[model samples]
Target: MNSHEGRPAGLRERTRRAVQAEIVATAMRLFLEHGFEATTMEQIANDVGISRRSLFRYFGTKEDIVLGDHAEHGLALRAALEARPADESPWEALRAALKSLFESLPYAPEEFIKITTMLHASPSLRARQLEKRQQWAELLMPDIAARLGEATDPMTRLRAHALVACALACSEAATDAWVHSNGTIDMERAYDEAVAAVRG
Candidate 1:
């Protein structure tokens, strides 16, 4: 077995992540309390007990703070998709994959709502989130393509693109609805409905 296979994060790395999480938590509270546009980097830094420069070292911008480490893009989706039954149809497989990926995320819906609500309210943040989603779509294409087959054909490539786009759009719609409802509606049920509507 590889010596590093199950190793825990080193102290420095753990400390770094702790601080990063603190920054996001602090920044989010400040943003929610004060409004995104009204909050300043210095305010976030002071609240997080870090210098403004140190805050920059952790995050490049307020948008980055709000979005907070886009994470390993589509890894959960890729793994979930890969684990899906091979015989399932494209739509069903994608639907399952989307549901699985949504369920596997670490953050709670309340946190997601705050962040997503903030993202929707800010045009620049929305644009940045779209850029992140595009990156996710690009990264997720090959895995989705492999599942849908015909990887060598241009049309298959297009189909994979469509599937990814639709799946992401479903995700966006579900989250938008969930945030709109202030988390009162069932996001997953909304997601299932969106997929069903598209798959019909």
Candidate 2:
């Protein structure tokens, strides 16, 4: 075996990740507390006790800090879709995957509501969010095409696009309903109703 193969666990990697997470968390809190445009990189760096240069090393731009690392999520979602039983229809697979996704939403509903509310009010962040979702749709389309067995066809691509769009629309509507209700109702129920509206 190569000498590097049996090396001790990488302490640097863990430390770097800890620092990065702290920076991102601080940025998010700042962004929520103050408007996105008002929260400067210097403020984030200061809050995290790091140099601005060090902060840039971890995230090139402020937007990257708030978005939290979605590149890995697409790969994981595709893998989940691929592992789904072959007999299931594309819609079925997508619905099941989405249910899992909704149930496992990373942040608390309150946090998501705050972040999304901020995003919705800000033009630059709104554009970035759209771009990120577009990238995710592009990443997912091919796998979906293969599963639906129309890899070479435009119609399949359209369907996949529509499906992702529909899902996002439903989730966003439900999120709005949840937020406007101010924690008085179960957000999961709102999400389910949104999905049902799409299904019907």
Best by TM-score: 1
C-alpha positional error of residue 54 in candidate 1 after TM-score superposition, expressed in Å: 1.1
- Tens digits of lDDT, candidate 2, 1-200: 67775454576778888998888888988998888999999999999998999888999888888775765665666667677887777666766665666566678878877877888888888888778777767766776677767778889888878876776666668777877786677766776788787889
lDDT of 1 by residue, 68-111 (tens): 56645466676777788877776677678777776766678787
- Candidate 2 wrong stretches, greater than 4 Å: 1-9, 183-200
Q: How accurate is candidate 1 locally (lDDT)?
A: 0.83
Compared with the true structure, all predictions reach lDDT values of 0.83, 0.76
Clashing pairs in 1: none
Candidate 2's TM-score reads 0.82
- Report the lDDT of model 2 for residue 169: 69
Q: What's model 1's lDDT at 122?
A: 90
lDDT value for model 2: 0.76
Task: Give the lDDT of residue 134 in candidate 2.
Answer: 74
